[model samples]
Target: MRLVIAKCSVDYVGRLKAHLPLAVRLLLVKADGSVLVHSDGGSYKPLNWMSPPATLRIVSPDDVELEDGVISQWIVKSTKADEQLIINIYEELHESSHDLGVDPGLIKDGVEADLQRLLAEQIELLGVGFTLIRREYFTAIGPVDILARDSAGATVAIELKRRGDIDGVEQLTRYLELLNRDPLLAPVRGIFAAQQIKPQAKTLANDRGIECKTLDYDAMRGVDDSASRLF
Candidate 1:
């Protein structure tokens, strides 16, 4: 059976729509499976006139095999969170089909992007101004995630995390030490932003004057998981 994969529309907001919105063409696999179609103007608008239903030809013995292949041209806007969500979505799709190799780098990039976006939004909502410095630098411990400005005009060092981890304190401590040592970042505050926190680590942080918090995705906000503030 010949599978004619129909053209579909994907929007700038990362939403998949039936018809194209404006002049932008949707990203899709060509019917012949020879090439992938993508939008050049940041949006894809599907043709309004209804033509024959788009179909995908099945050349394999099993119809399920048709859906088994990875998307050849996974086109995504270059934003970090958007790319991460795409990788996650792709991972789920691959797992369901049990036939795709996920790129580790891609997954890491996705995760970092998600963390960065969440942290940025949290900082903004919390009334803390910040800047994401995309500079290349090395440290005795490692690379710092984000450097921002606090309410007092002091530099702030922030690290983003997706889940609960024990090393957040130690990790932030190392970065904080480095920041304190640096003539430029010496006065900056150190912070760790995660989806959750560890108990003992939080206590240690409070003793040391470090700040740790959690970002609640469902609530669309940040919660102070600081030990000093909690108990």
Candidate 2:
């Protein structure tokens, strides 16, 4: 990774046009040819960025550019799309490169998968008499987060997310549609479970006759503590 703090102006052109006036900002260039322009604030989100599968070209300013006091110009062009980002650097405050070798990739801890596993162990949370059949129930599209049976012996196909958005609801709907096709699992119902569910997602799930569940992860973990000690 290469990091640069520079007095620069940025221009983006593609589906929409945007401009960042001259200021000292952070420029991150990743090994994958992705470039991110960031301000000091805004959490992890960048001010502007060109995703991977892009190319970066840096060159000294030309006569016209030099006349305007531009020292260097960097152009990042997307290979996958029609997007382009241009940065005109008048002065560089700092620059450094780090040789961090290949990453092992993210190891998530308390994400949706963990939530699904916890919910499967505590199936009764779904309702009294509820029992888990299995986790990652297989389907043609993908694995359903959890497959369980309700109190009345009805099949329940659940989709889990850390934050329930409309997309998560749509995913559960697809799984339910596919699962309902199987003769034995026919008439399968869906439950969209998450730690936090968006209002729009809840509305959509309710409209589709699918139940929305907000899980208390810490409470569920507390329930699991005793079980873990037994092993």
Candidate 3:
């Protein structure tokens, strides 16, 4: 990863046009050629970012830019889309590159898996008579969190996420596409269940005809506890 702290201004074009006035900020260039511009705050979310499969080109300031005191510029162009991010650097405060090796990916400490288990046992959370077929139901791409049949006996694939985002919707879409290809599950439907879902994700899921369910984690745990006591 390459990190730079500089006084810069940014302009983004494609789908929308946005401009950021001159400010001291952090610019991050990832190993995959992704770029993120971040302010001092805002947690981990970047103020502006371009995803991977992109190219970054550093260009010297032209005459006009030099006259305006611009020293350098970085142009990041997307390979997968018609998007571009241009950062005009006036002064560099710091710059460094770190050779961080391969990442091990995130370790889900059973929060989501536990939620899936509780939902599977209380399958009726989906509807009055929903029945669980299995948990960790295998598909060609990956194991779906849960698979069940709704009250109407229609196959339903449930994808559980702690915080639903657009990517989660996309993942569920792929699983549904694959699951529906089987003759027995030819008409499989999808339900995207999460503790909290973003509006954009909900809209996308709904547009794709996927049902969105907001899960109550505490309530689910309560149900699990009640069931355990009886057993």
User: Which candidate tops lDDT?
Assistant: 3
Q: On a 0 to 1 TM-score scale, where does candidate 1 land against the true structure?
A: 0.43
- Report the C-alpha lDDT of model 2 over 1-231, residue by residue, as the tens digit: 999999999999976799999999999998877788999997545688776568998878553444377899998998866878999999999999998997664344566767977898889998999999998775535578899999999999988888899988888876775566455677899999989999999999999999999998877877546545655
**Candidate 3, TM-score vs. the true structure?**
0.56
CA deviation > 4 Å runs, candidate 2? 62-67, 115-231
User: For all candidates, what are the clash counts?
Assistant: 14, 0, 0
lDDT of 1 by residue, 124-230 (tens): 64454555444213343355777777666777777666764657666777667545644555676767767677777678778778787776654553444444464
C-alpha TM-score for every candidate = 0.43, 0.55, 0.56
lDDT of each: 0.46, 0.83, 0.85
Candidate number with the higher lDDT (1 or 2) = 2
Query: Between prediction 2 and prediction 3, which has the larger TM-score?
Result: 3
After superposition, which runs of candidate 3 have C-alpha atoms over 4 Å from their true positions?
62-67, 114-192, 195-231
Q: Report the error of model 3 at residue 80, Å.
A: 1.4
Best by the TM-score measure: 3
